[model samples]
Target: GGEGGPNAGGERERRRGGRKDESDWWTRFQNDFPWDEKTTRNVVIGFAGMASAFLYFYFRETGKEVSWKDFVNNYLARGLVDRLEVVNKQYVRVIPVHGSYLWFNIGSVETFERNLELAQQEMGLDSTHRVPVIYGSKSDGTFLMSILPTLLLVGSLLFTMRQGPMAGGRGGGRGNPFSMGESKAKIMKDNIDVRFKDVAGCEEAKLEILEFVNFLKNPRQYQDLGAKIPKGAVLSGPPGTGKTLLAKATAGEANVPFITVNGSEFQEMFVGVGPARVRDMFAMARKNAPCILFIDEIDAVGRKRGRGNFGGQSEQENTLNQLLVEMDGFNTSTNVVVLAGTNRPDILDPALMRPGRFDRQIYIGPPDIKGRASIFKVHLRPLKLDSSIDSEALARKLAALTPGFTGADIANVCNEAALIAARYLNESIIVKHFEQAIERVIGGLEKKTQVLQAVEKTTVAYHEAGHAVVGWYLEHADPLLKVSIIPRGKGLGYAQYLPKEQHLFTREQLFDRMCMMLGGRVAEQVFFGKITTGAQDDLRKVTQSAYAQVVQFGMSEVVGQVSFELPRQGEMVMEKPYSEPTAQLIDQEVRSLIDAAFQRTHQLITEKRDVVEKVGRRLLEKEVLDKADILELLGPRPYEEKSTYEEFVEGTGAMEEDTSFPEGLRNWNKDQGMEESPQEQQRKQCLNTVSHA
Candidate 1:
């Protein structure tokens, strides 16, 4: 019994080993056929088509094996044929004596009957041994043959449908014939980590949106007071002003899910697809209630509806109508808050910007001096700096340099500065790196290696000096910050100025600016005795300014306050908004303005010839001069203009309360003098020329 127990245990172990081998083999088989459900279905369909094709060819070929003469002579004569079937009376199948049936074609039922009887009688076969005749419908086989291609086509469509809309080819979502009008908006159930602190600048805009976030957080408080939380808010601003970032920050502040999409994504080339997508997007928003739906660049699909001229634009209009219904439709209680951003609000449909639809239109312009400083602070947080670098001073200087820079431009400047520092293998960023970054942003990189003839260099120096002198003399012109004779960007020479952040411009100021623009060309003619093509951009700007003052700004004497500017069009046509007489008058006015500006610039250069020559010689020697250097050569003017950044801190009284900055750096010291002793005498001569002007 003990021996029997041992044998049984061994046998059990063997059986278990066999089962393990089977399991391993099964797993290997599954691994070899590793495909997704869609791929597997396609493979099965392909194999089915191949099998059906093979069967069709096999049956078709086998039917033609025995000829009519051979069937009668070989099989029928020997009485080997047991039975005959006439299928649709076009083909006859003969049962063989020892194998499967054989088939032959005949003309018709009568012919087949006659032939079979003749063959049977010729063989002298009796009724029992004769091949019995039976008729078959053959309609089922014909039906399958006719429907095989349709079944394969339907199977192919099913395979394509299993794949997503992206696989629908180049047309993408809307181009695909099989798409079900699904929403293209991407859903983010998780809260975005960006907070309001991450978005710098646009403080007022932020404050406006903060209330909306609070409403989302504590809706019951507002609801109890019968105050409906705003259904929507539109963040209208120029590009790169942080509209999308504000939306993300708002989502983070409210701690709600975010569904973001572009307005263009809702439109497509197909009919009804755009509207369907709008409905689907709204349906998704409703399902994910208490969430934020942010649509970026809404102007793409929400332009004035009927203004679109193309056949496909009707689809976009349909989408806009659907969007309007979704935003402020009858389902008012839905918790989804819509946030749209656009750069061109003027192009939007009037109905789309109605009160209930976009309850608040938050305009986010470029940051002010104070706002820019805050933005710099936010961006500079991650950079490593030298101990000598003062962040406050650097921020103030950067804000001054970038008066019209958006948040994105500020970030780019910071990044460029870092890159410049890294290129020199420096451990920390310094003031010079930031200065280079500012130059790169405004005037582009310095082409130090570009060779210039001595005459050309002298001409450039005089040209830039001409601008400085004119700007220095004109009370309304911007103050000259720096002058450079070295080539940068497309210009052979350039002058940097500190333009005030003023919204309105007077006619005097416009005239003074135009004179400043013509300074270079006038100087070129005076110093070189001829003009060059270097002032092409300067001329272009002057022309535009003159035309704007005459035609667009309505600053002309004869044109009155009415603007004669033509309507904006995508195509070019030889048509003027005014009649021939008015057009001639406008042209004459523009030319008169340019000529007057040039004469004033020429006169100023002629009177200040001494200062121009002195400054031009210095620029030729140094190649570049900053504010202190320029002031050293030209002396103090009667008027001193401050940058917007300086005025902002001074007006707000924040300059006095700041403890981080050292005392001497608080204000611009006018005491810095040139190394030469003759600077004082030259300064007196410069003051005399400015007073005379």
Candidate 2:
């Protein structure tokens, strides 16, 4: 009757649902919840229900009625109720309490919350019903969304710390360590302690460098007067002649920045790197204006390009190009000057030596006598030398001994002297020490203890005595200093001479010296009755001297005034400097000249046979002989004898004997005054009687 009152409807519903139907409905409801896909949904729903129930009870006890309609509008829609919105027919909203809610389509939580917030704000709902925003959480329920970005940022920071400034916040690259790559052309000031005074034996080079230094200091003085300073100067010489040292001294005197680098350092495996480095070097030099860029051994890079087949792809060629550009090309100015040093100027490219590039080429040759003496003084300044040590005499001796020695050799000789003195525990270096040093430098050490057979000893002694006796008789020969039978270095014996201070030689002098060289073999022939190979060095010397006389000095009458300055390659030819017929003539002449010299030597030795035997025997016993021993055996020279022509010519033969005549003279009559002696008067009367007859 009233649609069967509420209690009657409930009884009818229960009567229609049996136990099996109830269980089926419960299973169907659980299946509709999508528990696998949304496992936490049921838990969340149960918690929300319990929390709402507690709040409702608490509010109701406080005299606030929990209206069903109000709850549906506020708690259900906003607080206590839940509905699923579906886009079927007209956006149907079904309550979650019924199983029919399973058919409703639901938007994602983010979309739903966004729409609900919009609607609630539009309707001006209470602030307590509004949803809160999570910073990193999105519709997918992911958390800590900034973790990847934070990790990337930290990694970038660490990379920047490791890489330094030049690299773009990345580790491990070719970055300069000290930020010194961009520095201007500057030398290490601490190591630039080398002053001009420290350099030795290159006075000419030093003077030239001093002018450059002055120009660097006052460039305006020349510039104002319409004069241009040399852009560069090339120092050319043999090695160890102080070319590089002069350049450094110039830098020091100028007191400007010095950029020093070897020419080889510019070349690299990468072809373009050389040019790039050259550009960089020049850029630095330009920035440090009024500076010197010293390139040592410049021939390494500045060789004559395109002359040799070194493969067209040469870094040295590229470097040379860059150097040319930097030296005289578009960017060249007077501010930067180039200084190049090399021993081989002949091989250098002409471009490098042209007027604008290297305007001056200074030659630093081996030191002369004065320069050598000065060099010795400079080197000996630090050593303990006796006051009596004559640097000039030492220099003269060294100059003679070292024909092609540079300043560096003199320094080495000084160092060797010091070492010799040290070995002897000498407080100061004396003349003897320097002598030993010279011998060590020139002929190597003496092997005095070397054992030789009696025959070998005799041969050595005769050989050395031959040299001494021949040198004594030959007018133009160098004075004998020592003759030794002792083995030294490669020689079984040796004869040392006090070489004259003359650099030029006359033909007579050369011939006389050659004769002296031949004297050894002559002596061997005269004494031993046969020649041994002990005269190998003498033969070589004599042959060379004879050839020089014939070809170089034009001393041979057969090859009159003919000079054969043979090329270095043509030195080995047998019939050199003349036609075949002329060669025959030259050979004959050379043989005749050598034969006559040997004959003269043989005759002299025969005349002074006893003296020669005595000197040779003494040399064999003692292994060495000074000039005094040689003079004692050979007796006084004819020049030292004071006998007049008249005394000997008249047959008076008054034997003049004056031991105390003078330091130089050997023969004189003590009783004979400025007034003629009785024997001299008798000799003059006999000469008059002979003239009268």
TM-score of each: 0.72, 0.59
Which candidate wins on TM-score?
A: 1
How much lDDT does each candidate structure score?
0.79, 0.66
Off by over 4 Å in 2: 1-186, 267-277, 305-318, 330-332, 386-405, 549-608, 635-693
Residue pairs with clashing backbones, model 2: 75-79, 75-80, 75-81, 76-80, 76-81
Give the per-residue lDDT of model 1 (tens digit) for 29-100.
889976665457668888887977876775463644789989888888877877788877688888787887
Q: Give the distance in Å from residue 328's predicted Cα in candidate 1 to where it truly belongs.
A: 3.0
- Model 2 has an lDDT value of 0.66
Per residue, candidate 2 scores C-alpha lDDT tens digits across 1-693 of 476677888777787777769899889988887554124434755665675565455533122333333433654454333444433222224344433332222345565456656666766767775433222211211223335346545654444333332331122123333211222234633357667677766766676666566666666656788877778899999888888878877665566788888887666453355565566677667767778888888998899988655666666787798789878852234477788999989889998899989999999987654456566767877888788766655554455454456778788888998999999898888877876777667666789788999888898788777778777877887777678776778888877775554568987778778778887887888898988988888887777777667767788887798877644533455555568887777777778777777787788777767777788899977887876877777766543221222222234232221112231111112222224456657887999999999
Off by over 4 Å in 1: 1-180, 310-313, 330-332, 564-577, 652-693
